[model samples]
Target: MLLKNERISEIVDGKRVIVKKPELLAPAGNLEKLKIAVHYGADAVFIGGQEYSLRANADNFTIEEIREGVEFANQYGAKVYVTANIYAHNENIPGLDDYLRALEDAGVHGIIVADPLIIETARRVAPKLEVHLSTQQSLANWKAVQFWKEEGLERVVLAREVSAEEIRQIKEKVDIEIEAFIHGAMCSAYSGRCVLSNHMTARDSNRGGCCQSCRWDYDLYQLSDDGREIPLFSENDAPFAMSAKDLNLIRAIPAMIELGVDSLKIEGRMKSIHYVATVVSVYRKVIDAYCADPDHFTIREEWVRELDKCANRETASSFFEGFPDYTNHMYGTHSRKTTHEFAGLVLDYDRETGIATIQQRNHFKPGDEVEFFGPEIENFTQVIEKIWDEDGNELDAARHPLQIVKVPVKRPLFPYNMMRKEN
Candidate 1:
C-alpha cells in the first residue's frame, strides 16, 4: 500500500530535467485529513503536536490523539512525522522533552526540528529518533547540509528558496535525504521565519498561532493637508503589497522526481479535507504512471479537471520547478469553481441492488449529468442516470445536506466515492 513510490535510474543531466517521483508528503491537521492523505496517496504525513511547531492554530492533535494518528497512519503504510520545529525559549525545553518522549513512545517515523539547540538535544535525548531539519533552519548551500549531516540529522527539508539546480547539487554533494515543498501556500518572507504575524498579535506564529493580518487590505495612514488619513489604493492607486501566491508544482513532478528528492511536501496544516483528497489523488495517478514508465509519462488533462473541485488562486511553480512570477497568489481561501456542484457523499455500495447510498451535499435534479470522485481513481467519473431517496422513491432532485439518497449504477462503486455534477 505505497501511497507514492518512485525508484529512479541515474540519468546524467546537469541541464536536462531528469527526476524520480518525489514522495507526496501531505499535511494532516486532524484525523479526517490524515485519512484523506493516506487514502489518496501520501507517502508520509507531517502533523503538529500541541506546541513547538508552526500551524499551532490548526486543528492540531493532542499527545494521545497524535499517538493514535501515528498508529493509524501506519495501517495505511504511510509514515508519520511530528513537527517539533520550534524556535524555543529556554523554559520550553522541559515541555519539548516531554513531547519527544511521547512521540518516541508512539513509534513516530521521524521528527522535523529547526533550532540548533533543539536538534542537539534531540540527538542526545532521543538517540533513536531521526531528525529532519525544518526549512526555518535555512540550509541554503551544500556546506550547511554537510554541517547538519555531521551533526546527525538524517534528512533536510530544504528551504523553499532553493532552486531545482541547487537541490540537484545538494543531492550530489551528500548522502542525507533532501525533501522539498512541491505545492501549497507560499510565505512572502523566507521559509516562514517572519515575526510580522506575531508582532501584530500577541499570538506567536513561531509557536503556532498566526493571526494572518497579512491577508487584510490595510489602508496606508498618511497625513493630508488637513492632517487626516487617506486610503492610498482608493485615490493614489498603490495596493498593499503583502500577500503572496500559493505554490503549485503539479506540472513539474516528473522533473523533480529525477532530481533524487526523497520527499515532495505539501504545506497545508490549515487546509480543507477536500483539498487533501483532490490534490493527493491527482499526484498519485501521475506518480504511479511515472514509476511504471518514466519516459512515456504524460500529464493527463483530467488532473487539471479534477483540480477545480477546490478553490485556489492562480498557481506558480514556486522556486523548486523554476523562478516564479513574484506577483502570484499563494494564500489559500475557501474559493471553489462554480462549474460543478458537489451533489452528495458516497456511502457503501449495495451488492444486491447495484445502487449506491449517498448522503446528499447539494441538490441534483433528474436527468442531469454528474461526476463521481472516489477516495481513489478520483479524476475518473462514473455517470448516474437516475436518482432516488432511501425509501426507493424516485426524486426529481436531492436538495438537503446529509440527506440520505440512492443512486442507481450499472457497475459496482466503492465505500468512499463522491458524487458531483456540472451546474
Candidate 2:
C-alpha cells in the first residue's frame, strides 16, 4: 500500500509552479493533546466534546476546557474544531442545541457534524461557527459534496474510501473545502456507520458508545436440524477478519497537495498524547519538506521510522488510489508492532546543573539510551549515565511508573518534552 509521490506541476504565466501544501489537521482527545498537537505543527486540530461525537470513550473536552483550548490554539494561529457528529434522536436535539451555542460562545472555529438536523441546528443556534461535514456522512462523490455544501457546510471530510482521482474530480466541481483522512485507523464499516456495537452490546455506535465490537473476537456456530449445536471454531481460533490496517499516507503529501485538498487529516482521537505528538510531527516535516522544495521532495526514511514508533497496526494507504487488497486487513492475531516505547516525560531541566527532572512512563536504566524531542527542538540523544530519585537517593534504574528522577545531561531540555527508548 506504499504510494510514492509523483511530480505534479502546472503552467502559470508560461512557467511551471508546484502545488501548495494542505492544512495538516490532527485529532485531540483532550485539551492537553490538543495543545500538544498544535505545538507540534498541526495547522488545525479536531476534537470531540463530552457528548454527541463518535469517540465517546475518548477523554473529550469539557465546556471550560473547550474555551481554554480555543484560546490556546488561536494564540498560535491554529484553529480548533469541535466534533458534534453523532447521529441523534429526538431526545438529543435540545441538549445538542445548547452545546452548539456553548461552543460558539467558546470561540471554536468550526463544528464537525454529520446529521442533517445537527447541521441545520448549528446554522440556527450557532451560525457564526463554520460547519464541517464529518466523514460519518459517507461523502464519496462530487454530488454528495455539493449536497452538503448546499446544506451550508463549509468543508467536507470525505469518507476514507475516496481515491486521488475522485478527490480531484470532486474539487473540480465543488466550491467547498475537501478533507481526507491521511493517517490512522480505518473502520471496517463505511466511515463507522455501524450497527454492530449497538446490536451486540446495546451501546449505539452512532450515538458514540461504540465498544469496537468489530475488533472483538467471535466464534461462529451452526444449529442442525437435529437440534445439535456445532461449533465452527473457538474464539481463540477466530481471525480478526474485520480489522483493517492503520492508514499511513506519509508518501502521498505531494500528490494530496497537488489535488487541491484543503486539509490533510490524521484520525486518532482516543490515542495517546505521545501518539499525537509523534504522528503530527512526522507529517509536519513531510508536508514542510515538500512545500519548501517540491521538485526535490523525497519522503525521508526518518519520517517513516518516527511514524512506526506509535503505529499500532501495519501501515497502508487504504483506498487512496484504488481498492486495497488482503494486505490492508490485519487478519492474524499478532498483526501490530511498536518500535519504540515512551520512556519518560521531561518536567524541567536545570541549565547549570545540567540535570533534567523527568517523570518516568516506562522503565529505563541508568545505562539505557533515550531520545528527547519536543516543539521547535531537534530530537537529541542522551545516555542515562547517572540517575537519582527525587528522594536524593541514587538508583540503578527508574523502576516505577510516575517515578520522579534527575539525570545529568549535556543538552538543554524543555518541559513537556518526551523521551523514548527503543522497544
Candidate 3:
C-alpha cells in the first residue's frame, strides 16, 4: 500500500497519479451523523461519550446509544473510536477505572485520551482497548512519540503545529500510527489546551467542558500615551483580531496522502448531521475514486465544488509546507457556506431514457433546478423537467418530506449517486 494519496495539486494531466488509499477518519457528533459518515465511506469514525470528552457541547452518545452505534458501524464494516480525553481531578481519578470497563464492554475499538495518567489508568483498567493520544498532548518531537509508543499507545493525533514533513520525520523515527487533522477548525491554543477559557470562565478545556471563549470577539488593549490601556475603535464594529479561518483541505487530500499519513481526520464534534453527511460523502467519493482508479481523482472537479456547500476556509497542503500564513487562528469559526436543505438523492436512472428515481428527502416545487452529482461525472445540471409521484400523477414538485419524485436526468445516473437542490 502507498499508505496515502498524493495531493490533488501535484497531478500532471495524462500522467498517472498514484493514491495510497489512506484511512479516511470522519467525525460523528451524534448517531444520525454517524450513519451518514459510515454510509459515505468512512473507514473509521470517532465520537464522544456523554461525559469526559473535549466536545461536551456536542450531542454525544449515551452508553446504550454508543453500543447501538458500535453495532451499526460494525454492520457497515467501519470501526468506532470513542473519546475519553479529559483531565481528571485527583479525587475523581479513582472512578475512571469503572468508566473504561463500561466502554470496553460497549465494543469501542479504541479510546482517545490526553493525560498521561489516564493512559496509564486505561492500560491497567482496559488493557485490550486501543489508546489514541488526543491532540491535547501537543506532542511534536520524536521523544514524545517514542515515549507514547513505549506506553502502549497505538495512534497519536498530532498537534496542528507540526508540519507534515515533521510527521514524515517522526514516522521515520517512530513506529506508531500518525493520524493528522487533514481538515477542520483550529484553536489558537497549542493543541487546544489553552488557559484563556479558564481565566475568563471557570471551565477548563482540559477538563472536557470548554466554554469556547476562544471564538469570542475580543479587543486588544495597549498602554497608550497616558500609560493606561486604551482601546481602539474602527468605523465598523466587528471583530478585528480574529485571525483564524476555518481549515478546509478539500483541494489537498492527495498531498497529505503523499506524506504517508496513516489516517486523514476531519474534525467537527459539534457539527450538524447535514454538515457531516455532506462533507463525509464528498470526501468518501474523492477517496474511493482515487483508490479504485488513480485517474478518477483528477477527472472530477465537482468534488471540490460540492465541498462549497460546507467548505471551510478552503486550504490544501498545509501539512507538508510550513503552516499556511493563515493557520494561526484567534477565533474558531464555522462554515459560512449554506447548503440546501435535506433534499432527495437520485438512487438510479435509466440510461436509455431520461427517467430517474430519487430517494426522497425534502419536498420541492416544480421548475426547481436540482443539482445532480453523478459517479465519475464532474458536474451535472438538471432542472425539474418533469415530476412523477408514486401515485403516477404528474405533480409540479414534491410537497411532502421524503416524497419520492421521478424526474428526468440529462445523463445516466447510478446507484448511490446524489441529487439535491437548495430549499
Candidate 4:
C-alpha cells in the first residue's frame, strides 16, 4: 500500500493547515441496523430506500422507516444519507420524482445518486437535500470531480481505482468535498461496473442486481478450434478467481485524513447489524484518536483485531496504493476468519438487580464466558452464572433468535452494547 507522507498546503494567512478529520460513514440496510450504527459511533449512516436503491437484496427501509431512521439518526447528531443510486431507465423516471419528494419529506440529510438525470431531477425536485455523487459514476480524476462539482454535487465518492497521489491532486484542484471508500469490499471490476453478473445471471450489475458472480469458485477451461473443451485446471484447482479482498484502511486513517477526504465510507448494506456495529465502532475510535492528536497518532492493534473479527474476507488496502495485483485477490475459498461470533445485544439493563436483558443472536451456554463491549465502555468478559428467558424460566443456553433473556453481569451495562462468544 502507498504509505506516503503527502501533505496539502492551504493559504490561511499565507500559512498551511491540514483539513479536519473525515466523517466515519457506515451502512444501514434497515432501521435496526441504522440504530446499531449510530449507537456504535458512526458520524453518518448511508441507507437505501425501498426503490431506486442499488442493493435490492438488502432489507431496505420503507418510506415510513426512512422517516423513522432520519429521526433516529438526528437524535444522535448523526446524518442520514439515503441512496437513490440506481442507473435508471426511462420508465424509472416518473417514480423517481415521487421517491425524491418522499425522501425530502422524510427529512434525510442527503441523497447519494449516480446518474446525471437523477442528479438533475434531485436538483429540481428536492433542492433542499444535499446531493452526493455515488461511486457508481467512477470519478477518478480532478476534471471529473470538477465536472460533478459544476453539475452541482455537494460531495463525490471518488472511484475506488484512484491512487493516494491522485486523491491528493483531486482535492487540491476541486473545491467540492470528497468522499472515498476507505473500507469495504473491493469490486474486481472498475468500481462495480462489472458485466459478468449480467452475462451469467441475466441480472444487470449496474442496476444493483449483482449476484456476486466474482466470488464464485470456478475451474479454468479452454476451447479448441475443433469445438472441444479442454480443462486448464483440475477440479482441485478450482479457485475464487475474481474474489477481491475486503478493503481495510485502519492503519492509514491519518494519511487519508491529511489527503483531505471529507468522508470515509464503509460498504456493505447487506451485512448484518453486528457487522455494521463492529466496523463503525472501530473506525470511529481511530478517527477520533487521530483528530485529537495528529502528531502523536498511532494505529491501534486492537482496532485492526476488531475489524478482523467481523470482516467476511481477508483485508487489504485496495488501489489506495497504485495498481493492486494478485495480492488483492483471494484465490482460495472465500471465507471470514472471525475469532468470535455475535452472541446478543443488550436490550435493557437492570442496575439494581445486576442483570441485563438481551436479545440472543447466537447460542451461548450459562457457563460460557463472553465479552461485553460498547461504544464508550471498555470491553470486559464475564461468566454467565444464569440465563433466564423472559418468562423467568432458567435456561441452559440462550439459543433462539431474538429471544429475550436476562443474564447476570457484574459491571454496569447499557443497551446497544454487544456480547460475543468465542467461535
Query: Each model's C-alpha lDDT?
Result: 0.75, 0.85, 0.73, 0.85
Best by TM-score: 4
| RMSD for each of the candidates | 5.0, 4.1, 5.0, 3.6
Q: lDDT tens digits, residues 1-423, model 1?
A: 011243365354532223455678999999878877887779899988787878777878887887788778889889999898878878777766667777888888888998877787776667667899998877789889988888878899888889989987887777788888877776766755787777787876666666766665555667899988765556655456556666777778877777777888888888776677777787777777776667777888877666655535556676775666644643234233546666766777887988888888777766767777765443445556777877888887787778898888666677656667776
Cα displacement (angstroms), candidate 1, residue 360, comes to 4.1
lDDT of 4 by residue, 374-417 (tens): 98678889888999999999998888999999999998888899
TM-score of 3: 0.80
lDDT of 2 at 295: 71
Clashing pairs in 3: 6-254, 6-255, 7-254, 7-255, 164-319, 244-329
In candidate 1 the C-alpha lDDT for residue 264 amounts to: 84
Name the lDDT value of residue 66 in candidate 1: 79
- Superior by TM-score: candidate 2 or candidate 4: 4
Query: What does the lDDT read for residue 177 in candidate 4?
Result: 83
* Candidate 2 residue lDDT tens string, 1-423: 011233445556665555555889999999989988998899999998888888888888999999999999999999999988888988887787798999999999999988889898889999999999989988899898888878777899998888999998887787788889999988878965688988999888888888777776655678999999888776556553777788988888888988878899999999888899999999989887776667768898988888988877787888997899888876656355577888888889999999999999889997798988887578888788988999889999998999999999788988878899887
- Per-candidate clash tally: 13, 0, 6, 0
TM-score of every model versus the real structure: 0.84, 0.90, 0.80, 0.92
The deviation in Å at residue 139 for candidate 4 is 0.9
Q: Which lDDT value does model 2 have at 160?
A: 87
Shift in Å, residue 214, candidate 2: 1.9
